[model samples]
Target chain A: MATTNDYLKGTKSVLPILTGLFPFGLIYGVSAVTSGIPKVQAIAMSFVVFAGAAQISIVNSFSSGISIITAVAIAGLINLRMAMYGASIADSIRSDRLLTRIFSSFLLTDQVYAVSITEKGKNMNTNIFKFYIGAALPIWLTWQAATIIGVFAGKTLPSWLSLEFAVPLTFLALLGPFLVKSHFAVSALTAGIVMVLTRNVPYNAGFFIAVLSGITAGFLIKNRKGDR
Target chain B: MNTSHLWAVIILSGIATFIIRFFFIQIKQAPLSGKVKELFSFIPPAVLSALVFGSVFENGLSSLTPRNPYLWASILAGITAVTSKNVLLTISTGMIFIWGWNYLY
Candidate 1:
C-alpha cells in the first residue's frame, strides 16, 4: 500500500508531458464539435474513449456518414498500440490482483507508457500502477473538460487560432525526441513512403499499412545489424 | 443525431479497443527479442508521421503540386517541428502561415 507521497511523486514526473498534451486536448474538443458531434456527446467521448486518435477517427467517420461498424474498426485499429503499451508495463507491476492490473491497463496511453518506462529506469521499486493512475487520471479529466469547452464554443472559435494544428504539432514534438537513432529515421521514412503510396486505400486503411511497413522496416534493419 | 447508432459505434469501438489492449496484457510474460522491441519502438513515429502528412496534404492521393499555401505552411511547420521540437511554436507558426496565406491568396 503506497502512501499519498508515493502517488504524488509518480504523478509529478508526468506533469510536464500532460502540460504538453493540454492544448491538443483543447483542440480536439473544438474539432469534435465542429465535426458535427453534439457538445455533450463530444465531451463524453473524450472521457469514454480517452484516446485522441480514436476519438478523432470516430467523430470523422460519423460526421461523414460512415457505417458504425467501420468507424469502430478504424478507431480500434488506430489504438491497437495501447495493447503494446500495456504489455510493456505489465512487468513493472508485481500485483496479483486482477482488478488492479485491469484498472492500470485501462489507463495505458502512449504518454503514460513513455513516462512510466522512463521513470522506471530511475526508480525500480516504485509502485508503477499507482504512479500510472496518478499521472493518467489528471490527463483524462483534463481531456474531458477541454472537450466540453470546445463543444460549447464550437465554430464560434476562431479559425485563425486553429486548434487542429495542435494535434499534429504535439506528435511532431513527441517524435523529435525519439528520432535520435538512425533506425528510427529509416522506419519513419519507410512508413511515410508507404502511407503516401497507399493514401487512396478506402476506409483509412492506409494507417495500418503505414504501421506495418514501419514495423517491418525497423525489424529488418535491426536484424541485419545484429547479423553483421 | 441517431442515439442508437451512436451508442452502437461507441460500444463496438470500446470493445475493439479493449480486445487490442487485452492482447498485450495476455502476452506480458513473453520476452520480446531485441528486434521485436526495436520494431515496436518505430510504430509511434511511423504512425504519427503518416497521420500528420495525411492531415496537411489535400488531394494527396491525386496531386503533388503545391496548389494550396496551407500545405506549404504545414511543410514549414514540419520543418519547425523537426528543428525546434516545440509544439507551441510549430503550431502557431503553421496556423499563422495558413491564415496569412488564406488572407493573401
Candidate 2:
C-alpha cells in the first residue's frame, strides 16, 4: 500500500525528467503535424502509442514511402527493449493483483524505468505501483499538453531554440551518475561510438545493432572481471 | 497511405508494445538467472548512450563540426551533466547556451 508521502515523493522525483521531455514532446507534435499526416491523426498517436521514439519512427517511416506494416514493424523493433525493462523490474512490485500489474505495465516507460528502478534499489519496502503512477501521470499529461501546443504553434516556434538538443541532454544527465564504474563507462562509450558508425543503416537498424553490441561488450567485460 | 492504414499502424504498434511490456510480468517462471540479471544491469547506460549519440550525430560525423551550435551545446551540456548530475539544469543550460550562441554567431 502506498502512502500519500510515497506518491508525492514520486511526483517530486520525476519533475526533472518531465522538464527534459517538454521540448521533445513539442518537437514530436510539430514533426508529426508536418510529416504529411493529418493533424488529428498525428495528435491521436500521443494518446495511443505514447512512446516518443516510436512515434518519431512511425512519422519518419510514413514520410519515407514505407508501408504501414513496415512502419509499425520499425517502431515495434525500436521498442522491443521495453520488454527487457519490464522483465528486469518485475521483481520490484509486491502486488499480485492482475489489475495492478496491467495498470502498471501500461505506464512502463524509459523515464519511469529510470526513476522507479533506481528508487527500488535504494529501499525495498516502498509501494512501487503507487510511485510508478505518480511519476507516469504527470509525464503523460505533460506529453499530451505539449503535443497540442506543438501542433498549434509549430510554425511559431523558432529554430534558434535548439529544442532538439534537450533529448540528448536528458540522456546525458541520466547517464552521468552511473559513470563512476569503469564497466558503465565502457558500455556507454562503446554504444555511443557504434551508434555514430552505423548511423547510415536504413530503418534505424543501427540502433538495435548498437544496443546489442554495446550490451555484449559491457557484459563480456564484467564477466571477465568475475572470472578473476 | 490511406487513413485506415495509418490507424492500423497505430493500433497494431500500440498493441505490440503493450504485449511486450506485459510479457514478463505475466509469466510465472523461475527468477532470472544470475548471469542474465548481470547483463540486464548494463542495459540502461548502454541504451541511453546509444540514444544520445544517435541524436547528436544524426546528420553523420560531419555535423559535429564547430560550426554546429548543437555540438558546442552538447559538449557544455555533457560537462554540466557530469559535474552537476542534474537533469533540469543540464537541459536548461544546454538550450540557453545553444540559443545564445545561435543568436550571436
Best by DockQ: 2
CA error at residue A167 for candidate 2, angstroms: 3.8
- The TM-scores that each candidate's chain B achieves against the reference are 0.70, 0.74
Candidate 2 backbone collisions, by pair: none
Query: Candidate 2: which stretches are off by over 4 Å?
Result: A1-42, A52-85, A88-100, A110-139, A201-203, B1-9
lDDT of 2 at A213: 81
In every candidate, how many clashes are there? 0, 0
TM-score of each: 0.83, 0.72
- For every prediction, compared with the true complex, DockQ reads 0.49, 0.51
Highest lDDT: give the candidate number.
Answer: 2
What is the DockQ score of candidate 1, to 2 decimals? Answer: 0.49
Q: What class would a CAPRI assessor give candidate 2's docking? A: medium
Q: Would you list the C-alpha lDDT of every candidate in the order shown?
A: 0.69, 0.77
Candidate 2 residue lDDT tens string, B1-105? 676788888898889888978888777653668777677677777777877787678676777787877677777887887888876678777889978987898
Per residue, candidate 2 scores C-alpha lDDT tens digits across A91-206 of 76535899988877877888998898888888676777677788888989999998888888765566666554555676677778767777877888898888889988886677
What lDDT is reached at residue B75 by model 1? 72
